[model samples]
Target: MKLHFLGTCAGTEPMLDRKHASVAVECDKKLYWFDAGEGCSYTGHNMGLDLLDVKNIIISHTHMDHIGGLGNLLWNIRKLTQMRSELPHFDGVDVFIPNEDSKDGLLKLLSHTEENFCCDYENRFYGVQDGVLLDDGKVKVTAYHNTHLVRWETDKPLSYSYRIEAEGKSVVYSGDVGLYTDLDPVIGDGCDALLIETGHFGIDIAYDYIKDKNVKRVFFTHNGREIINDREGSLAKVARLFEGRGTICEDTLTVEL
Candidate 1:
């Protein structure tokens, strides 16, 4: 399996070498996108990734920084299919979103685009709820609601974190949380890798949270001013604190696991 980092910056003013938060996990030649941050599709395509192979797109929340490129992503997929004269690997694509209003708004916007944004392939949207979101025999994904966003209603959750298990390896994605404890449900006993966000928290806080959690590796994304302003210093701190188990991810970085 391969992990591709398309965007790593937090929801802040534009940065030099980063966008928002986005990543893709490729297993068995199929792509599963984690977030559709700005320029994610463009970055992935330029990095030689096959966008047509994307079978599922899972959004952590409806925040603009997280779903900014969603419409453009779908548009690019259709454009590429027409340009290549080839059908997508899958007959349809599945989009898991936490908010129905965001999905409806995006679809409404696409309705006025070129060709009415119509295509031969189907693009279906599903509301993300806690529990197992996907299980294809090869990869299993479980969603856990987080406190990043508040929901007055008890039934619907507004944000989530994910646990991905595949090929005997477990990976956890901490999609923006109000507190580190918000991921206890998904982290369970432990995981091989944890893709954590440092936008609302500090690196030390994250390190302390998972110090004895049995995590093998930690990849930091959705960075904030602390890391962005002093990258070298932050990296040095991570090296000393994590002892080679943590990394500050950059755009277009691909890791084989």
Candidate 2:
């Protein structure tokens, strides 16, 4: 399986090297997008990724930084399909979003476009709840709720972390978690990779929290002060704590496991 990092910056003002928080997992010629941060699709496609092969889009939450480019992504998909004069090879796209309001907003935003704005291809949207999202033949996706927001306590507990198991390896994506322990259920005993978000927390804090955990590789995303302001120090801290087990991700970086 291949993991592609499209954007690695947090929701800060524009940075030179990074965009936002987006990643893709490619397996068996299919692309599964995780988080649609600003300019994600553009970066992904320009990096030689076949965006037309996208089958599933898994969103962690509705934060602007996370879904800022969602509408543009859908528009691009449709634009490419029209350009080719063929329906999407998959014929359908399944997107799992945590908030229905955000999804509805995206739908409305797309509806106002040109050409009567009807998508020739099929796009199915699913409101994600806390549980197993999918177990495709090649990959397994499970969602665990966290405490990022407190708007609607009655409906959803709020944010989420994800555990993706594929090709004999497992990866945990910390999607703007409220706390590190919020992933206890999903992280469980161990994972091969941990695509953690450093937006709300520091590198040392994250390293200390997962030091003894069973993760083999730690890739930092959605960066914050530690990474942007004092990168050398953060890299030193990770090197000392993880001893090469940790990696600071950048836009367009790809890794295979």
Candidate 3:
């Protein structure tokens, strides 16, 4: 399996060579989208990822920076059907999102786009909750609630982190946690890799949080100013501290797990 980073920028203003927070896990030729930040499908397509093979799209939250390209992603997948004769083996794409309002709004917005957002393949939406969400034979995705969002009217969570187990390896996505410790339960004892988002925090805090943990690998993503503004310095610091156990992920980069 491999991990492809489509966008690595945070919610901040546009920066050089970065878009937003989006990542895709490729397993057995199928794609599992983690987030659909701005231009995610565009970047994935350009990176040689076949959007038709996208079996699932999971969103951490409904924030614009996190879901800005969700509609386009769906639209592009449908558009590709006209250019190709093949359909996914599943013949559909399942989306897991935490916010029902965002899903409704996206569908409404897509209705105004070309072809009235019609597609031969089914695009199903599932509400995210804290539990094992899906086991597709290729991968098992589990969701855990985080303190990224709170609601006074309901007990539903508006943000989540995902624990993905595939090929006997486990990976945890932080998904913009409110605190580093927020991932403790989801991470459990350890994981093969931690795709920790740095959009809301810095590398120092990230390092400090995981320094003594059993995490085998670390990939710093959703870059913030501290790392993006000083790539060389940050890379050097990570290399020195983590000693090859850490990496600073950039857009369009793919890594094997």
What is the TM-score (0 to 1) of candidate 1? 0.97
lDDT of 3 by residue, 1-257 (tens): 89999999888887669999999998999999999999999999998999988999999988888899999999999888867766544488999989887788889999999878877779899999999989978799999999988665986679999999999999998888889999998889999999999888888999999998899999999889888889999999999999999999999999999
Query: What is every candidate's alpha-carbon RMSD to the true fold?
Result: 1.3, 1.4, 1.3
Model 2, residue 162: displacement in angstroms? 0.7
Task: Write down the worst ten-residue block by lDDT for model 3.
Answer: 82-91
Give the TM-scores of the predictions, in the order they appear.
Answer: 0.97, 0.96, 0.97
Which residue pairs does candidate 2 place in steric collision?
A: none
lDDT of 1 by residue, 44-120 (tens): 99999988888899999989789998898898888888887655454668999998778889998998999788888
As a whole number from 0 to 100, the lDDT of residue 156 in candidate 1 is 65
Off by over 4 Å in 3: 86-90
Worst-scoring 10-residue span by lDDT in model 2: 149-158
> Whole-model lDDT, candidate 1?
0.91
**Alpha-carbon shift of residue 66 in model 1 (angstroms):** 0.5
